[model samples]
Target chain A: MARTILTALVSAAVMGVGSYAASAATLDDVKAKGFVQCGVNTGLAGFAAPNASGDWSGFDVDYCKAIAAAVFGDATKVKYTPLSAKERFPALQSGEVDVLARNTTWSINRDTALGFNFRPVNYYDGQGFMVRKELDVKSALELSGAAVCVQTGTTTELNLADYFKANNLQYNPVVFEKLEEVNAAYDAGRCDVYTTDQSGLYSLRLTLSKPDDHIVLPEIISKEPLAPAVRQGDDQWFDIVSWVHYALVQAEEFGVTQANVEEMKKSANPDVQRFLGVEADSKIGTDLGLTNEWAVNIVKAVGNYGEVFDRNIGAGSPLKIERGLNALWNKGGLQYAPPVR
Target chain B: MAIGVTNVPERSKSSGSIINDPQVRGIFYQAITIIILAALIYWIVDNTVDNLRRANIASGYDFLRSRAGFDVGQSLISFTSDSTYGRALLVGFINTLLVAITGIITATIIGFLVGIGRLSHNWIIAKLSLAYVEVFRNIPPLLVIFFWYSGVLSILPQARDALALPFDIFLSNRGVAFPRPVAGEGAEYTLLAFIIAIAASVFFTRYARQRQLATGERLPVLWTVLGLIIGLPLITFLVTGAPIGFDVPVAGKFNLTGGSVVGPEFMSLFLALSFYTAAFIAEIVRAGIRGVSKGQTEAAHALGIRPSLTTRLVVVPQAMRIIIPPLTSQYLNLTKNSSLAVAIGYADLVAVGGTILNQTGQSIEVVSIWLIVYLSLSLATSLFMNWYNARMALVER
Candidate 1:
């Protein structure tokens, strides 16, 4: 009986040596550090890249700015952590970044298995192919036996295979890890096609030696729901990040632009009142441990969801991608948000 | 001499004094070390298991069998997107082996020639070798790969305007395309004959060695072996009607079609590794040769031997004793340096494992595989070098 008790105690001691306590809340860490550590892509034009003045601005950058606005009431309080696709997840897991807003795709393996919580997707995207205009290829189906260039270790690579296999088309893929290398390969005429997200195709084509020489194929191969993600464990911070996305969409649904938000706060509409935090009885901001004026800050910093879309990647930017499927629910698109009240 | 007497009795050892004894203390120290190591290993395994379970990632070798769904730029074996991740890694290993072996052969030849050139009487030849070594040896290998990949190969013309070379060869930015030989019926017989010729050459070499020991006269075994090997293979090919054909590359509207091409990725990696490693090897060769005392060559000349014969017969054997150890290190460095294939997309083991790591979210398993494979390759190389060194060291006696 005594030996059995001693063995149990020793085993318990060994168990304590292996498992560790979870990390502190990301919100608390961010607050204590006075800046949000945001993980972003090394450089993808429409998603995340530095400008001439070395300031980061893009769809993903604006989202991180929105997050910062929600927390600190200041959008410029974010310090970006540029990471490659291969190092992104490990960097998050190692606590080198507070939030990952790198236009990362949400998938089952990344969410449940990789110890992450993906907020709602900010962009609805799909895989497509870009080929030289001289090839006279109009559709992806005409790409049989074509040599395709793709980035390795991406959902785009897998989707390319599935699309080809499903269509019973043959292709030879030239894969590279870096976007620059893939672009160079395609530019050097080593491959006939380059496959990636449609928005990416637009952005990448601009960087090509001859942007006018290529055309994107008219095929949307697979769904790529690009979302922001945070590490698991710390449900409150997850709720804050998740609700920040919903608040932006809800503000857009309520027709709350940055310029009109303050004026809209004086209107008699109760839904808009609660959304803008003009109604003092509203608990949405308090529930997330923020001021009732949080949504106003987000809108002022990066505007509502539609405004963000139109400016960064939609009609205003060089990419000029249309907001077809990314429009609000009432306008025949899929973006729907819950009521702030 | 006077005998001395002691009044005190000799001290006897007690159980408490066992720590003072070297043998007993040695055992105690080793026991402590073993226990500590075992504990550390157990702790690490437990931590990894706990982390993996918490993350809900399935841990096992089962992921290797899943669909890779990715493409490699170059593969030695047949592969497609539908191939398994295990097959992808195998392709990567084959590519690495191809580069390492090919680089070693080319580097050795260039290194020996440059080393000999540096020792030449001509001032121009010696200075040129010195310049070659200094230029390559001081620069990073990664930049060298980029220099060849981007600066040289990427600047070549497009496939539609490929620079045509002799014998159905085409050079472009894509690659160098040459006719691929397709074997026909009865090709197996020729391969069998070639194998037989190699076996015969080995036996002939052993026989010549025995004859030399017995009669103190050496046979012309090098020429005999070369003739048997080449002549036997040639005779078989002719007898079999030389049933082979080439699928020559043809210039097309946009591509040079119907032939195999060596991609620029492979060419850049191969060239960079060979040139970079050859520089260090040349220095080692030069030092090894210079380490041999001048007295040995002079002794050979006093025996009325020609200068060329003295350098080959007397100086070379002694220089090899100093060269083998450092030469093994350079060979190993070249093998490890081949992992830089990722920088230019040649898809070596490290690069392939990196892709799998991201795809499967299996960082631990993939990294462990890389560590084990590189360790095994290094050990196997060192083992072979040790065997060769032992054989050479026997000559000293």
Candidate 2:
């Protein structure tokens, strides 16, 4: 007993000393490491999963790359850490990753209590239900006594219960820990309905044995504004990341395509010139501890937001999600950037 | 007496002093350790607080009482997006328990059958069991879950074209819908009858055992107990007007409209955990049977015991002595592995805690709760197993 006490005391002392030394800014340490460790999902097709050649591509993936471009001027300067929903926040809290660009929802508690800051909404989604077409279910209200297969540990679960309860309907929930299981349960007739963010439903539907057999309910029960998140405390890093996203929006607004970025550098318009580093007097990039051409570099590396979305989850892609809410402000969507000047 | 005196000065020594005096060094080392530990703990706590404060994040469990504005995919109890964080977590805990219990029961039955098969005289049975164990054991549990869920389950028929199974069960790509029991007014009387029957059966079992010991004759206690347990409740049901019915599932235009539905998350986790843990349990069972010496069975046979009796009376009891300890570990492992429910969204403890943590940002509190719950579960299980093992152990003369 005495020996055990002694060992415990010794270890406690060591930990105390160790933690004291580790209280410094982790952002600085990340900068020195030359790569931002970004946590992402395993495989959501267009979210963070690997392609055929194991290269990460998607709107979420580009967000991380854009941050890398802004910080180091090299889009490839990032290490991707694949995390499950349970592991995502813990990874960020433990300093295992610098940024989480996965399709995580932005909520008040996460922002205030979890010590994380959601930069901006990248995808606007809502909780929706999908059922087999043979059931001919047209609305969520029709799922009175349905067995709903839902992924656990998500906003979708709450939305499901709320929707049912509000309608005075009873349902059984078949909960899975992962999206794949929910998909499986729905497919195997283990559940009567599968519900999640509509985008996720579309992604899942594509992999179904008979894709045309299922139909998503027309009603979107809950709003799910998905965004990238970064650990709080480093104001400078937060600004850099938040504005990296803003830069994308700003680039799109100023008609700065990757193909025309060079030509636009010599434009007569001062806002366009200032954005492309042709006229560096605005000092926007320098204020964030970066060069005036940071936005230019980001666009050159990953293109604008629309390009990234189109290549990933848009109509041109397999997921084929329309840019209804994710379109630019001028295009009648929620994406708006604070002017760079 | 003739030895030369080499020491010039004698050091001061206590009367009770010895070379290996534990009091002297033990106290000294313990004090040093305590001081070091105290310092370390203080530093870590200080660092955490400073870090959180610097990051402008509050660290506490107070957020658990806040409204959990998010939704859960599945819950046994009623929950809403406007529910408290505490309620959300409760739902998650229930989901975890559901999966763990179901997995444990199924895994045990499968493991026993496969274990017996592994020892069968028939080469085919033994080989099949071996192959089952090897294939499942070699693969990761997560992959197995995925394979069952996405690879197989997702490809089934749609809800409208559900493949009807026996007993009004419907199977479709969406999920299986089945008849659910509806308890009526006389159900209370039936439950009471069941309890009474169970008590009577226990008493009779003791009496039968005593009678057998005295007369050297065995009574069919198993059949008697079964009859008492089932017959009494069933008779009460008939006498009370049979107040039990099932709500059968019905097909609708878009989905199955009425019936009880078991979701895919439970199915995949249940299947995966059972198959994965069965491999380990099978190994334990095989070792247990092997541990029983051949002489014990031979002795029983020589005493005119039938082959079945010899196996049961001689081999099984002895095998159980070796099996219980490892079996307990397997049970604990299955319970812990149930935490993998996060992978398939089964709302197990870990997954629920994760949701709460994400919503509340109470990392310290959430992690503490997790550690405490899991550790206590581990301790409780081990304690129960130890007690059981002691009961089954060989008694010395």
Candidate 3:
């Protein structure tokens, strides 16, 4: 009965939206709706958590805000849908959300089979492990015969299993469907160790009952390039999301902070002028289906990538994580963008 | 026909107007309804398939052969992350059946006791049973699961400070760890002895019933059956050099090692489901018992039967006729509710299916599999119960 009802509802939705989708672009849909529907993490402290006033403010949240600001010239014009790890992809594929900025990993399987387009790695991360202080375990190699807690439906689960099997070590897995459940289970001594992305481990560790009692290990097992994803087959929409991240990184590379962005519009440098959309007859933003002030709106709304990181999970926030690999290319990092001719 | 009946006129074969004929109208309306229904189904399926194709999303069960890449918390069969998704789902199905079958047995036993207690002449017992039913039946099962998981089990001592029990068992927030029985050489003989003991007990039971009918003397069947089962197994074990040994858990640097552990996730899900379903079953039992007419009990008492024997041999046997049907529904309900194991990470069918769906992006196929599997399970339960109900049904001359 449930299957029949679900199929009916899905088919009805498809029939209603399919013809419109084939004719109209995602931008037009957003324009008609007057708000960019963004999917985000349910809660991850400095990543995408809601404050006491029920307002979302975090690293992933700012990306969606920047998208809304670029499209509508108003950051607050974006609505948020908090999704679990398992619900993120389908929600985007079904047109329930415009873009998924939920710290999702960029993988070939997701990009192709799941019908999502991902580019511009937002955060450079690696899978790591966290163990209790008293466990006296030093490295991931020494975690043999230990019970490890991890969340389901994420790359971390597979990474943990692969890493253990590669090293010929045996470990029991205690998996949960949600992040908070994994946290609670680990905190309750259900598992000796917790495993996830290193950055996630840091943010989630802060939410534990005693943050001082646990320590993240120093082994980087898998490269986890977390990025925002949009539904496949819409090259224009994909380009818009991809370049939004590049614009943030480019703005930071050009030393354009949120406060100095407006002033930088009057700079004599042709590159900076064109990037800020102030150069005469510049069509960079128009070609991407937006106004000349698209970059300006993004900068004004969420600032550059550096500022976003600092304010949310970096030194300006509680996480205090260093800009190890998320820095610009000139500063010894992987964040490099195309020239804004 | 009129000539034969001698009083009534014969009816015509058909109405003058075909539109006015009731049979023709009924068939026409039915045909129209069928056409509309078929058209609607076709439209929905067509649109859904077109949408999936346009979106470039893969929609098939080919991903079942792919590596699952994630480990389950508990599995009855041997499973690893290297196993295929199909094997993982099978493991999940087995886990679900394990919980459901155990929960049904435990709930039935508890339900019978509480149901009988509700009707006890003692005031305290009746009220306590009433309170149990009222409290559990009113609250949702999910909250009960959390209450056991987060509220009760999480507060237990950690692994390093685990509470040790007798027989090398240890209890902690993680789980209860006990000795794993390792069956060595000649262990099959003990299993063979157990099977022989069971067969002998069944034969003895028939013989005892026949002897009672023939000679008017009762045999001690229960004790004899118990002795046969236990003594046979013990004698075989000793004769076979006691080829079973325990790998007792020893406290290690982090946790107890060398033994099998039952995780708290399974424990809490099982406990919560059993308790929650037992309340409804208790009500069913009470209704079934009360449904038996009072004169039946009086009639048994008027005979030479004692009070206890009257309730057991007379009242309970008849009450079972009423009990078995609803009892089947409760069993089905418990089986379905085992899907709630996912909420607590018990690795039941729904939880495992959700993981596989996310990994492979086969939402429609996965949901269809779930629908088919659950329908089969429910149908199987109903069939077995119907067969049992037929046997217990009251026979009339």
Candidate 4:
């Protein structure tokens, strides 16, 4: 009797697998809802943290705002769903959020097996370690026999393990579920080392009680090309999101800013004219199922990618991160965009 | 008078109309109910599976064989990041069992002490126990865990300036590091002697009981049993050469090196679960003792039994019949509450499973495994407690 019931239950569960699976009209859904649902980090200083007034503004938040502007022509036509490291993927998978701009790393396992579509890396980060200056540990190699604090369920945790194992070093891991907990634990002296992306280290350091007391180690253990992700199987949505990133990069390369985007529309440069939809019969935005003014709206809403970075995490911000690999392709960086034509 | 009746009415007889028959109606309604319930369950499962598949989320237990690629804070068995997810989960399971078992033992001891103290004639003792119970019971277990973790343990001094205690132990914010025992050659003989001593003590206990039954005189059974167990192991260790040594922790720049250390995560979770569960267990213990008849204690006193002996030998035995069932519940509660280890990153089953689920995106598979493991743990605890309860139950002639 028990075996029969179990078999029946299993069969019934399998039968339910694809009953409500097909949902490719994310754009339409967003249109109907009148806002883009964006998943972001619960609280990270420069990438995606809310201010005291609960208004989120950061490098990642700009991507979310750009998407909303592309879709609805208004940056504020969006809602933020702050997620933990463990909750990000499920939130995206379950359609609880339209897109995740959560400083999430793009990896093959996540891109393929996890059914996520990641493109156009927004932030090129690498895993690094931070230790108190008093420890006199100038190099990651000296991190052997140290207790490292990290957040659980992140690529950083996996990379830390692989790095230590490859180096044949012994270390203890003190993992927490939330980023804030990791920060607090490390600050409380529960661990000798803190490991995460280098950018995150710099960003989080400012929030530390003694930010100047700690220094990031020089070892870049893993490539963490953090990007915005949407659900897979929606090529239209994928194109829209990936191209939104490209448009921002192209705008930056074309010397557009939030203050000057409208003025640049009258420029005689054919490429700039076509990009800002100044040229008649330009199908760039329409091809992606958006208005011809989509790029203009995006640039107007959040400026270009460099502007977003500078305003949130670069010289204009307290993070003061040097845009080393994040600079434009011609400027010895990796941010390149395909021609709009 | 009833036996004189020529015919007796059938208890389950029906009238001419089948709808009027209660038995038939009951069967008919039950069949419909069963069918409805089965259909509802089938619909729910089918819809959920369909939704998951449509969402492109893979659901299966096959990911267990993959590399965990993550390190746990504490493990009783040998484990590393290279270990498979299955092994990581096993380590987590063992950690859960470790905390639950230790928490249960400590809770019971504290619970019994406090329960008796609550009834103490001394007002100070009674008030203290009451205060302890009320304070713990009123707060949530998660808050208690945070209190110990962030409020207490995190405030400890750093590793480089660790507080050194007696016997080469070190206390720091990282955790308590102590000397770990490493067995040397010939240690097997000492272990063998310990096992043999246990077997001998069992026989000695039987002999003493039988001797008392026959001679109506008691032997010094406690002292003899203790001697057999302790002396045999001590003598064998000296004869075979003391084969156990301590690997004491030495203070280092980063942390204490070369010894066993219990992380603060496990310590906080265990401490929180124990204190929280002990409150409920104390109340159960007090109620059990109170449930025991007053006559039993008075009768023991009349038999010239001392007050302490009367409480232990008479009142307590009867009280246990009332205590064991609820005590089992408290044990199960503590075990389940150990899942809160995730909040503090104690690497218990739920925390480890959560990491795997996130890594693999196998939410359904991981959730099912948790349900099965927790259900099994609860059932096993219930089985053992039921057996113990049976032993303590009254054996009426």
Candidate 5:
């Protein structure tokens, strides 16, 4: 028994030493594996969730597929890890995921202290309050001495308190850790008001027993610029993900739909030709350590930004969210991309 | 010494050397284990440091003092967006304790009744108890929480049309609202009288036990204790001019206008934990009662003791000896399961700690705090239970 135990100890010590010497940046590992592990929110409609057919289809899920197309010529090479709000950052930090495509806000502390670099905002949202219309409350200011339901571990909770304190309102907060609980409390009449991002409010309202009874107050309390994030210390990986999102916006601006992407390769326009992977020697894809057909693959797999948004969250979908801040630059919204070249 | 050895009888000896001795082997094994444990810990620490550096993330607990810039849903103490992360964690700890304590109490009462019902002579009662245990024990706690929060609670009436219960209590899909106490100036005197009544009850219980042992006559101990607990407090309240009033909730145009409200997050978690844990507790209780030999009951009956007296005086005391150890462990399990509060967003320790971790980027610190707090709580509970068990142990002549 003693001899067996000694042998086991020595072998374990050797394995530990070997692993310590072999540790490297997860970005390189993900690149070599030809896939990016993306952490996403679990079952948020239009954000990230599976459909009835067990296939994931959402705005956030598209970002993950786009990154995979950028790295490899196949969008299906990516693995999606559905994580809770509390699990997203930890999964990224522990190297369990290569990128986080969940609808995370870009905050100063999260950027500098958490060792993450966020790309441009994909969704511009604001915290808002929703109350049952039976109360005849048209504005949030009337919610003095009210009981408000807010989700825990979110910016919504902070905004609710700030809005109340600034208005000198004395209110009690009915807090829950998950969005479902907040909605439940609101539906149950445990709270007179429910507060969250406007997009989330729309999605949650649809799940209520009487959707038309609740009215979203006419106030945008806080700026919520939802963006995609990648880990720090991997400039190569960061550039790849950033450019992938930019490509989608650029595609929309140049009128390169998935139906016309094949025909656009023969166009005389230099910018369209380059973005279509047919001009300027196709150097953009090569520079990012991918094949020249990368852009073609992404568009074919997921379509342009407008296509993704309209199908998932726009008027055509259940959420029916308007493209107020997410439209293209020429359309008078904040979404604009630099030249592909 | 050598001269005497020549005259001694020779003994049969094995070929074992001192280095190959069992005692030596045991020591050697212990030394190896210690060395391996130390080396493994060193390697993990080294790897973590290198990884953190490569990721460019700083690791420390200094972030606890940083501004939280976040707010919690339910807090017993005052907090703000500008409160420190430490304060947020304190709020989380209090929330966890509140849910755990309430869950344990409710689970115990339900579990004991169901356990006794399973051993009933009637076939229907036993079958019903069996069905209850099977249904709850088969389902996961998370699903149960969702079932209650969304499936049931969300279907309740609207705030304006709340279902009114007795004593000015209101129920709706949102949660239950109840009348809160409004203490008056003379409340202290009434509280003092209640405490005095409890002391009198304890004294009367001891006196009743001694009277039954010496004179072989029984006293109505239950009635006396009840009167001391309730009647004395009532008299004291009248003498003090009724020192309390109710803050009854009034229905407003939009919502309930006054009194206190309990959120559905807490209600769902409390309900789920109690029902789920009671299933396991019921099984433990049934086994405990069954573990007592049947001969003890028959012997008590042969001594001319009534059936009810045999159960109260002989059967129950013996079954408790078997029940308590397992019962204590079940209570601990319920406390730990309360951490699932993160799922339904009840602001328990794990959920609150998770938020602080995100705001500060201090994963190691936050996880360490969780481990230390939970482990210490477990240890303290175990120690207390051990002491109680020793006091209740049978003493032999």
Candidate 6:
């Protein structure tokens, strides 16, 4: 009798899986809500952290603001919900957030099985190891039989295991669920090494008890293409976010920064005129269902791509991270955008 | 009697009369309750199905076979990132059982001592036990965990400059490292003797109780059992040429080389849980003891029984009736409280499950597993405790 009831329950549950999945009109929802609900990291120094007055300002935070600027013409039309690494995907899946701009790596499972669309990469990074200076370990190969501290629920954990196995090295991982716990464990000498993204290493080092004592080893283990993601099946909303990202990179290539945007808009170059919406029929913005001056709004709110980078995490900030691969294509870097036409 | 009696005819019952009958009303209410309960269950199942469907999340146990692809800090069983998600959870389950069993043992011992101390005649002893109980019980368990984890353990000296203990034991912020025993050849004979000693002790207890009942002569059962259990094991070791030695830890460039090191994660979790739960157990003990009447002790004294004998013969056995029920709940609470191991990065069941839940996006499956594991653990504990209570209950002739 009990077996019959359980069978009936399983059939009912499977029926639910067979039904039509809910899909919301994200653009209309955002318009009705009057603000873009953006998901961000809980607290990562150079990526996303709130200041004294509780206003979030960082590299990822800037992308969220840029999208808000493109959509509503006012960058402040965004509500930041700080989510942990595990919570980010679920929040987006449930439509709790319209856009997830957290420093999440773009992966195949996330894009396909999780049913989300990732825009272009915002920051390119790779996994690396950091050891205390006194250990005299100059490279990743030296970390043999070491206990490495890493945060769980991240690509970093997977990469660490793969790197060790590939090199035929033995190491124990002291895994923590939260980023802060991992940092504390490493600082307390519970582990011989700390491993994560080199970008994250640079940011996390400053918060350590003795920052100068640790140095990141030179090893780019895996590609971590951090990008913004949106729920699938919303073409108009996806196009808007994707084009906004392209416009920022193009603005950087055209050298149209926030301070000189107005002067650049009046230039004789047709490429610049079309991009800044000054030309008679600059319809690139309208194609994505955004205003003709959408790029102008993005630049005005959070400057161009280079300006935003410098303001939040580049040499202008405390992190002082160099623009290695983040520089423009003409300057021997990977960041490039297609023509506005 | 015959003169006062009058004959009367019985009245016929109508069909409508059954509606007002008490038994009929009871049946009506019971039927209504069962129907309502069934409907409620059906409604919940429907809502869950609709939600999962709408969210586009696959719901099944099939996800358990997928690669876990994540590392746990500690595992009692062997594990790797390439292991199945099911294996990862099993490793976590074993770790949970390990900590809960150890914590339960340690907590009960400390709790009994403190409970007895609270009633001591010495002013300082009573005050100290009372303060310990009040302070630990009043504060949140999580706070105590953090106080040990981040505040005390993290502040210890580096692994290179470990505080050396006797027998090549080392203490540092990383962990506590001590010599691990290696069983040489013929150690199995000693192990076999140990088991034999345990079995003999059990039979001896039963025999001693029977002798006391039949002959009215008490055997020295405690000393005899202790001697048999320890003496057999010791003699076996000596006869086998003492084939057991320690693999002592040696100081290294960065860490201890040979010792078995218990990580700070497990240490903090075990200590916090033991101290926090011990406080509540102590209170339960005090209440159980106080529940025994003073008149019982005096009655024993009237029989010329010594004070210690009076407590053993008259007070404790009866006090156990009050202590057992609450003490069982305290054990269950400690097991549930072990879930806070996640906060301190202890690789207990819930923490490991949480990591898998995030990695696979299988929140529903993971939550269902947690519910099942905790439910089973609590149920099994309650069953054991109930059996014990039955054996200890007062009997009437």
Candidate with top DockQ is 3
**What is candidate 3's lDDT per residue for B1-397, written digit by digit as tens?**
7577766443333558767877678999999999999998887787777787777788878889999988887988999989999999999999999999999999999999999999999999999999999999998998999999986555789887989999999998878999999999999999999999999999999999999999989999999999999999999999999999999998876778888888888888888889999999999999999999999988888887899899888889899999999899999989998888877888988889888878888887777788799999999999999999888888786
Interface DockQ of candidate 1? 0.32
In model 5, how well does chain A match by TM-score? 0.89
Candidate 1 interface RMSD (Å): 7.8
Candidate 6 structure quality by residue, lDDT tens digits, A15-64: 34322222556776777778899999888897899999999999989888
Model 5 Cα lDDT, one tens digit per residue, B12-115: 23435767666677899999999999987998676666666655677777777877777676788888877888888999999989988899899988898889
Model 3 residue A341 lDDT score: 83
Model 1 per-residue lDDT tens digits across residues B1-397: 2333355344334445766766678888999999999998887677667755654555677889998987776888998878999999999999999999899899988998898788988999999999999999999999999999886556799877889999989998878999999999998888898999999999999999999999988999999999989999889999999977899998764467788989888899999999999998899889989999999898899999999999888888888888888988988999999998887778898788878877887766777787788888888888998888887773533
Residue A224 of model 3 has an lDDT of 97
Error of 6 at A162 (Å): 1.3
User: In model 2, which regions exceed 4 Å deviation?
Assistant: A1-30, A44-49, A120-143, A146-152, A167-226, A280-282, A304-335, B1-42, B66-84, B87-95, B98-139, B143-156, B171-177, B212-220, B253-259, B297-309
Q: After superposition, how far is residue B184 of candidate 4 from its true place, in Å?
A: 2.0
- Which TM-score value belongs to model 4? 0.95
Instruction: Give the runs in model 3 whose Cα sits over 4 Å from its true position.
Output: A1-24, B1-16, B211-217
lDDT of 1 by residue, A1-341 (tens): 12212222232233243123224467877888888899998788878999999999888999899999999999999999887677676656545677899878899988876778897888999899999999888899888877788887788888988898889977777778778888888997888899999989999998999999999988999999998988777678888888888888998888889899889989899888888887867886877988888999999999999888888888988889998899888998888887676
DockQ, per model, reads 0.32, 0.32, 0.56, 0.45, 0.33, 0.35
lDDT minimum window of 10 residues, candidate 6 chain B: B6-15
Instruction: Provide the TM-score of chain B versus the true chain B for each model in turn.
Output: 0.91, 0.90, 0.93, 0.95, 0.91, 0.91
Please report how far candidate 2 places residue A215 from its true position, in Å.
5.5
Error of 2 at B26 (Å): 5.6
**Which candidate model has the greater DockQ, 1 or 4?**
4
Candidate 3, residue B304: how far the Cα is off, in Å: 2.6
CA RMSD of all predictions: 6.4, 6.6, 3.0, 4.1, 6.2, 5.5
For residues A20-74, write the lDDT of model 2, one tens digit per residue: 2223554467678988888887678788778789888777889989988887889
**Against the unseen true structure, what C-alpha lDDT does each candidate score?**
0.83, 0.78, 0.88, 0.88, 0.79, 0.83
Q: For residue A67, what is the lDDT in candidate 4? A: 95
